[model samples]
Target: MDVKRISGLGRNAAGDLAKGVRQVGPGGQVIVVRPANSNFTLQEYQNFVNNFKPQQPGVTFRVVDEAALPK
Candidate 1:
């Protein structure tokens, strides 16, 4: 499985992400890593999930907190 690291999320980015996910087919995994202090709001997060969910119903999505990562 090829891993892709995206800097952040936006309309175009999300679209591209969805497209990539579709290309990967089902069982694909998408791990989103947030910054140490992220400014993304709850609604935005929900929207992000909503956007990708329909595109790839079988894909797995995970959010990783950067601060929680071992330095």
Candidate 2:
């Protein structure tokens, strides 16, 4: 699977998300890996995904907590 990884989410996250979506192209996945100490909340991440869904169809946007990743 084609994946675009992004570290943390901030005020300028949308731009990065857009770039990631474009980089991965259609049907690709953009994974935003949030750091443990990130100031952004899960709700914010979800909001970003929700907002982008309509704008970019076929592109998968996901936010994963860094702590949840397998070591």
lDDT of each: 0.61, 0.69
What CA RMSD would candidate 1 show? 3.2
Q: What does candidate 2's lDDT look like per residue over 9-39, in tens digits?
A: 5446667777877778778788877677867
Which stretches in model 1 have alpha-carbon errors above 4 Å?
1-8, 19-23, 41-47
TM-score of 2: 0.73
Name the TM-score of candidate 1.
0.58
Q: Evaluate model 2: give its lDDT.
A: 0.69
lDDT of 1 by residue, 1-71 (tens): 32344445787657656766776778777665556555774345546755665365678766566666679
Clashing pairs in 2: none
